[model samples]
Structure formats: C-alpha cells, structure tokens
Target: MEPVLPLVLPLRLRIRLAQGLWLVSWLLALASGLTLLCSGHLLVQLWHLGTFLAPSCPFSALPKVALAAGTLALGTGLVGAGASRASLDAARYPPWRAVLGPLLVAGTAGGGGLLVLALGLALGLPGSLAAGLEEGLGAALAHYKDTEVPGHCHAKRLMDELQLRHHCCGRHGYKDWFGVQWVSSRYLDPSDQDVVDQIQSNVEGLYLTDGVPFSCCNPHSPRPCLQSRLSDPHAHPLFDPRQPNLNLWAQGCHGVLLGHLQGLASMLGSMLAVTFPLQALVLVGLRYLQTALEAVGGVIDEEGETQGYLFPGGLKDMLRTAWLQGGAAHRPAPEEVPQEEAPPKEGLPEA
Candidate 1:
C-alpha cells in the first residue's frame, strides 16, 4: 500500500466534525421515524380516497420520502465518522478507502432525491391528494350500489365505512342521500346511463323513506333512527351541532377527511423540510471527510465502480489527476513537516 498523505484538516477540527455528524444523524433519524410511525396508518387510510380516481393517488410517493430521508441521513453520518477514523489511521479501516468513495457518491444522489421530495411537498402533493379524494368521493356516491338491487355496492361499502368511522353523511350532508327508499343519488354520473337506469329501477311505489342511511345516525339516536320527523330539536333551543335532522350528521365527509389529510401532508412536509438542512450539512461534512481520507491515501471507489485498488492508475491518469487537483491538491496543513532529509550522496571516487 502507498504511504498515507498528510491530512488536509487539523486533527481536532476533523474530530469535532465527525462527532457533530454522528449526533445530528441519530437525532434526525429518530425524529423522522417517530413522526412517520405515529401517522402512517392514518395516512394510508386516507390514501383510499384516491382509489377510484383515474391515474391513482398523486401523492403516493410522498409517504416514503420521510423514510428515505431518515435512512440516508443515518448512513451519511455513519460514513462520515468512519471516514474521520480512516483519516487518522488508514491501516485500521483497510476497507474504508474503497467504501468512502461510493458512500460519497451515494450521498450526492441522495441530495438530489431530497430536492425532488421538497418540490413534491411544496408544489403539488396536498392539492393533488385533495383533488383525487374529492373526485373519488363523488364517484363512490354515484356508484354506491354497483348492482341491480341496493344490497351489493362495493363503492357503497366504502362510503358506509367512511360515514360511520368519520361520523359523517354523504360527501356534503344527510340531504345528499335525498331519500331512504331510492338509491338515485344526486351524485349519479350522467355519462353512465346504465348506472342511472339501474338506480331508478330500484325505487318502487309505496316505499317509505328515511332522510339518511344508518351510518349517518348518531349512536345516541333512538334505535332504528329514522329522520322523517317526530323529534323536536327546537324543543331544546340550543342543541349541540344545531342542525335540522339532529339525529343524523348534516356535514359532508369530503371536507372533514380532506382537512385531516391536509394536516398530515403539512406535517410530513414540515418535518421533511426540517431534515433537509441537516441532511445537507451532513453531506457537506461527509464530503470534507472523504477528501481528508483521500488525501491520506484512501482508495475510493467511484460511482458504479468496485475495484479501485485492483487497477493502478496509468501514467496519463496520474498526470491528469495531478493537474486537475492542483498537482497534489491544496497546500499542506501547517502542523509539521513530514519529510526527512535523504542520506548524503557518496562522492564518485576515482573516475
């Protein structure tokens, strides 16, 4: 192996940078992991809002961004610390000379990924998600009963679940259902004439009606709650929520769920943003550490390369590197002169 080159940075400064990288990397990973873990389930549930939408969810890639950020941050920090050690004692970390090169390249790629992630958060993720949910929600209502009779609508099943789980009615209100006996929802798509005909055929003569489905009814509402009339809400004058059909939820599911998803998107964006600067700093430090190690004769593998040490540099390559990197890189550190005087040459004797 070639002799180690003198370090570019002072020993104490390099140590400080390594310590900082390690500390920040751990903290960033912990924070991102916890935040995502707590909210991931809910985010996944809301992603269903984009299920029926054409082209699917625009924010599908959003959730994984946090995970990637955390992973990269942790890896970069670990590599930085290792590079620092290699700079001090290259022989101990024999493989690092090869490892550090690839890691630095990966860090560069990771930085680009972070930039794209930031753009996704800022430019269009929340809005696209909301739009998809809105369209999907409406489609669910229109196609509620995907059958001849009112019993077997896959879309309706999801809608009912949404209503019950969120304490909501139709996309807007209980009135959105229009009538209990009829499945001809106002949300019916005019383009699908067959679906419209099927829904109308389900409604028959002499059918009694309730204002909303069971899912929209409050748990405290009387058993088999039917919101045709009977209950006098004005009797109390000031009831909670104060809507005409007091027994049934009057609000829409769209606004409530959309708001929640928006909140989640904001949080994801914010936390990701917080990590951005720290990750950037770590990459910078990591690059510096890589430089120091390289200066100390570390053999780094370039991007897509594995056998840097196996192949020696050609005469042309060394000259190219020397010229591009200021001959032997920058000025040496002011620590101490590493060179020793060569032994004096013996005089040519009796020529």
Candidate 2:
C-alpha cells in the first residue's frame, strides 16, 4: 500500500487551530466548573427535599439527573483537553520529541480542582448549610408555639387523644402500650429464644390487661391503672391493621439512604467539573511560558524556525555559553594546520 503523504496545513489554519483549541479549552473548563457548582446546589436541594418529600418522588430522581449531566460535561471537557494537547504535540514536533508536560499540567490541575470542589460542596458546605437552616427554622417555630394558641390547643388535644388511644399514661411503660418487652437479664440477652419468649409473654400479658375492662383500683397498689378510666372510644386500633409502624420505619430508612447516595453522586460530579478545567489552564500556561522562553533565547534554527527551547542543542549551548562566560580560567585550544615538511619528504623518497 502506498503511504499517505502528510498534508501541510495553511498558516492561517494552524493559527486558527491553536486559537480555537485555546478558546474551547477555556470555555469547556469554565462550563464544567459551573455545571459542577450547579450540580452541588441541586444536590443540596435534593437532600432538603428528602426531609419533606417521599423518597420515591423528586428527592430520589433529581440527584440522578444532576449527577448524569454534570458528569457528562466534566468528562467531555477533560477528554477534549487531553486530545487537543496530543494533537498539538503531533502537529508541532517529531513523534519521539513531543512534550507531555503541558498535557499533564492541564489534566491534573483541572481534574484535581474539580475533585476537591465536589468533595467540599457535597460533604461540607451543603450538609452544613442544610443543618443550620433546619435548626434555625426549628427554633423560630418553637418561639411561635406559645403565641399560636388555637393551633397549640389543637395540637395538645390531638396529643391527648393519641395518648388515650395508645394507652400512654406516662406511668405505664411503652412496653405495656406497644406490646414490646425490655429484657435486661444477662441469660436472656445472649439467647434469642429466651428473649423472644420473654418479649411475647410480656407483650401478651400487657395487651390483655390493657384491653380488658377494669373498675377503679387503689392508686397506691403496685398494679394500679395509671390512666383515669375515661369514656372509651371506638374499641379497635387507630392505624390500619395491614400497614403498621413497619411501613413508617421502612420509609424513613429509604429516605436516609437515598439522600446519602445523592450526596455522594453530587460530590463526585462536582469534583470532575472543577478539577479538569483548572488542569487545562495550567497546561496552557506552561506551554505559553515554554514558547516565550524559546523566543527570548533565540533558539531558532538557521531557517528562523523555532523548535522547543529545552531541546538538547539549546541546553548544551546554554551550558557551554554560561560556563565560558562565567569567569572560568580554562580556555579551549585552537585548531592546528600541518606544515609543508610532509610534501618535501614524499619528493625525497624518489631521491
């Protein structure tokens, strides 16, 4: 197969390419950073929503969207910058002489910056801010509790009704009301069978005593009914029989887990966004510096073509010039010419 000739680009095209790359790099870096920042905010909002909304609703979905968008933007920017550096190197130098410093600086600075920012926003700032806001709101609401007499009255009445329904008279333990058991005994502690048996017996006995009708008993008795025997309401459970406290517990757990996951995703997204752009900027700066150094040092070839300044010849020249002009006494010897005595000896061979 015939080898394809390397296409020579016009000077305008080359300049445009450089400028375009620079512009894209800057824009992408900026965009990635901003997207990450926004993603962080969204993450915070999602967590805040989780406090009020059900886990399956906006609380669960928004973070996934933010994470997906932010990650895509960040990753694209980083990949573009890397690819641009590689292309630039390929165009400017021989394959073996291409420099990697610019690429390294660009990738590292941008990637690293984003990483740190994401972590800070996700783990530190958002969580702290949310907590602070929640605490402040709680305090404000607490202050208004006394002034809101009607609402307070309603709340108190509701509490009283709940207490009556649950058989929570403060004197009767939670175990008696909820059919739960507290086993402090050491032998029962280790044995699951014993624990279960104790809990069952306690719960059944408490439920039976509480559920059954009883007349007035002496308050001083150890088994005195703590609650005043008020008029009984509807005789069954307040909550639905099928769905119990288990549903509430499960919902709470789901919300907590979803919030944490969203926070993590947001943090990762932010990190990607901030880190790569900063790195690209650094690389561009380094490349600019290298170019400037080459120009100042007059490291161009005879054809007035400037190669990289830190090339082998340039470094050697710099060292040699520096040493010679650096006040060293040692001097280089001059070249010698052969005398005419050798030609005369050749002619004398005939003699």
Candidate lDDT values, in order:
0.59, 0.41
Cα lDDT for residue 94, model 1?
A: 67
lDDT of 1: 0.59
* Residue pairs whose backbone atoms clash in candidate 1: 97-299
Report the CA-based lDDT of candidate 2 relative to the real structure.
0.41
* lDDT of candidate 1 at residue 201, scale 0 to 100: 60
- How do the predictions measure up, each by TM-score? 0.63, 0.31
Query: Which digits, one per residue and each the tens of the lDDT, describe model 1 over residues 217-285?
Result: 888776345544323444444443344536777578878877877777677666666666666766666
Candidate 1: segments with Cα more than 4 A from true spot: 1-8, 35-43, 47-57, 64-70, 81-91, 147-152, 179-210, 221-224, 229-245, 296-351
For model 2 the TM-score comes to 0.31
Assess the local accuracy of residue 6 in candidate 1 as a C-alpha lDDT between 0 and 100.
28
Best model per lDDT: 1
Residue-level lDDT of model 2, residues 1-351, one tens digit each, is: 211222223334444444565567656666666666666666675554333232333233434444554564455455545544544543443331234454445445555554454444444443343343334323322222233354333332332332343332211222222222111133244357644554567635321123211211223344334221122333333433233221111122123433555555565555554544544554544344334223424211223333232233455566787898774656655668766564444445655
Q: Lowest summed-lDDT stretch of 10 residues in model 2?
A: 245-254
